[model samples]
Target: MTFDSLGNLYGTTYEGGGEKSEGGGTVYKLSPGSSGWTETVVDHFLPTGQYGVAPLGEVSFDPHGNLYSTTSLGALGVGTVLEISVNGQSRIFSFDRVDGAVPAAGVLVDARTKTLYGTTTGNIYNHGNVFRIAASGQETVLYDFCQQPNCTDGSAPFSGLISDEAGNLYGTTEFGGANGLGVVFEVTP
Candidate 1:
């Protein structure tokens, strides 16, 4: 979960909100009230649709207060990057399997550039990748993991990303390094 400037905490659930059979998941907000804390369902992911389901990470907010995250399923059965704003929720990008698939984490928003970055756990190469979504919604694979021999560069990034002031991205993989035990990596993006 992440705290907005207003101190409201935001996050997502991997399941719930939709029909019991569907269990598409939901985004929610927690606000600290005078007496106690209040919880509100921000967005309910559809049980069946072209949109995504099973959100697996915390929600991120851009400078404009627009929320962003990824789903582990839907949109051709791969996954999607989504946005929630005053205009309502929308899928900003979908994984096609070739470029990447299964984003197991949320996105990192560059408040200044309005760009989003995240990692996928699988791709055509089955090694995962780091991607960039431009403010205009164009998706680019910034770095494909396991590019080096023996995948010493790491593979299967199953977490979100963090950036330094210099704009370098850092995250971890679930497996595939020198010892086949996963790795923490950095990307220039």
Candidate 2:
């Protein structure tokens, strides 16, 4: 979960929305009220559709107060990055397993540029990758994991990314380092 500037807490559920027995999940907000905290369902993921479902990441806000997140499954049975604004929700990008797939984390928005960065747990090679989506919606794979011999560079990044003031990205992988026990890595843009 993450807190917005107004102190409202936002998060996503893997299941529990719509009418299906295995619901498609929901994005919700908790606002501190005079009496206590009030919960509101911001967006409900439908069990069936092309829009995507099962959000496994937290929500991020851009400079314009638009919210962003990733779904672990649905859009063509892969996943998608979504943007929610006052105008409503839109899928900004979808994973086709060529660029990347199965994003288990949310995106980090560059407040100045409105660009988005995140990691995927799987790709065509099942090694995962770190990607950058430009403000214009063009996606670029900044780094593909397991590029080195014996995958010493790491693989299967199951988390999101963090950036320093200099714009270096830091994240972790679930497996494939020197010891085959995953690794902490850094990428320069």
> How many steric clashes between backbone atoms does each model show?
0, 0
**Which candidate number maximizes TM-score?**
2
Q: Estimate each model's TM-score.
A: 0.95, 0.96
Q: Report residue 103 deviation for candidate 2 (angstroms).
A: 0.6
Give me the candidate number with maximum lDDT. 2
Worst 10 residues of 2 by lDDT: 16-25
In candidate 1 the C-alpha lDDT for residue 67 amounts to: 96
Clashing pairs in 2: none
lDDT value, candidate 1, whole model: 0.91
Query: Which parts of model 2 are misplaced by more than 4 Å?
Result: 20-22
Model 1 Cα lDDT, one tens digit per residue, 139-163 = 9999999999999999999999999
TM-score, cand. 1? 0.95
lDDT of 2 by residue, 1-189 (tens): 999999999999998877757679888999999999999989888867676999999899998889998998998788999998888779899999989999999999999999999999999999999999998999999999999999999999998899999999999998999899999999998
